[model samples]
Target: MKHKSLAIPYVGWMALFVVAPLILVVVYAFTTREGGFTLDNFSNMVQYAGVFGRSFLLAFLATLVCILLGYPLALLLAREQSRLRGMAMLLIMLPMWMNFLLRTYSWVFLLERNGFFNTLLETVGLPKLDIIGTPAAVVLGMVYNFLPFMVLPIFSVIEKIDPRVIEAAQDLGANSAQVFRRVIFPLSLPGVLSGVTMVFIPSVSTFVISRLLGGGMNLLLGDLIEMQFLGSAYNPHLGSAISLVMMVIVLVSMGLMNRFGEGEGEAVLL
Candidate 1:
């Protein structure tokens, strides 16, 4: 009874904040400004297919880049016995301590035409980069901001693996590569799945990164949604519809990832 009473505040908070907002969003999504029920909001979504495609494509690219960069770093960190590992992790997390907008705004200064990156390249007698206001820039921003989310989960899972299990594999004459491929990698699927989810969701729905880095040329789904609610459009109904669709798609994607993870686990066991 004590536990139940203690849980009541949290439950009430969820009901008031989460559930209530979701319900309101659903109601708004399915109705017109005057409260007439309509499906036009969903029907109108077909016109924004390009935005949806571009958002998902950029997000996928960002997630892939994060995986490539973060996995190796995480593997190294997990295996490190020196104090340098702590320092490295701190460095990785340092940028995250600052405001998210501030971090992204700093990239704008670095990636712009006359920005620090190009100026440095010019000083070195190399051709200046013109990647800002492009999809590439957006992907770079996503990777920079979200790479930690990928690294931490994988590192946590890998660090927790039983040392004896690895020793047993070695005792069976397994080479380092064989142990990693057959044992460590399979066991790390949960972390990979978690990392992928963490990176992908935020990347897909990001507006600030796209806005600042893409310089308003590349409109993503998040940009569209934001425009509807807060920009000149002023259409919360349409925004809610878009949000609902995005939520559904995200849920489906997460479900598929979970299934894939389960299958991978089973296959490794077999």
Candidate 2:
């Protein structure tokens, strides 16, 4: 009875801090100016359908890039001895402890018109390419920020995998590629799914990275939501509607991953 009594206040605190804001957003999504509940906000989301697709595409591209870049990096680090592996992991994690906004702004300094990349090209007598104000820049920023997400998950899985499994395959006359294809790759699927989940959600909602890297009028759903809340529009309901849609998309992806991951299709992505 005492234990249950002690838990009551903590439950109340969770309700106040966590559940309350979610309830408010749900209320905003359903509420209408007429003081009645309606799906008008959701209907407005359908009216702006193209924006949703653009956001989804940008996020997909960013996730793909992170997987491509981070998987090999994780593998390389995992191949090292324990001390070196610890150092490499620290190098990846150290940047995350810094302010995210500061890191985003640093990209602005690195990719702006007169920034280091452009200046380097000029110095090399090569044509200066414009990265800022482009979707490519958005992908670069997203990959840079989210690469750690992919690396860490895969690294954890790799570390747990017994090296003897690979050795056994090799002893049985399986070559490097064959051993990896039959054993290592299958074992690493959980890590890949975890990495995908980590990268996808953040890439979709991250606003500052896209804004700083993708200067000018390149649109992203997160920026649109921010504009709705803070700019002249000031429509909380619309922002909530977009937020709900993004949440649904992410949830659906997770559902699909789970179904495929544990099923016969496990051989494919797992």
lDDT of each: 0.91, 0.81
TM-score for predicted model 2 compared with the true structure: 0.90
lDDT of 2 at 228: 77
Give per-residue CA lDDT, model 2, range 1-270, as digits (tens): 657889989999999998998888888888876658889888877766777777778889988888888888887787777798888888999989988888878888888899998999999999987888788988888888888989998887877889999889999999988987898877887888888878888888877877778773666788878887886678888788778887788788778977777853332232
Estimated TM-score per prediction?
Answer: 0.96, 0.90
The TM-score obtained by model 1 is 0.96
Candidate 2 overall Cα lDDT vs. reference?
A: 0.81
Stretches of candidate 2 off by over 4 Å are: 1-13, 263-270
lDDT of 2 at 31: 82
Residue pairs clashing, model 1: none
Highest lDDT, which number? 1
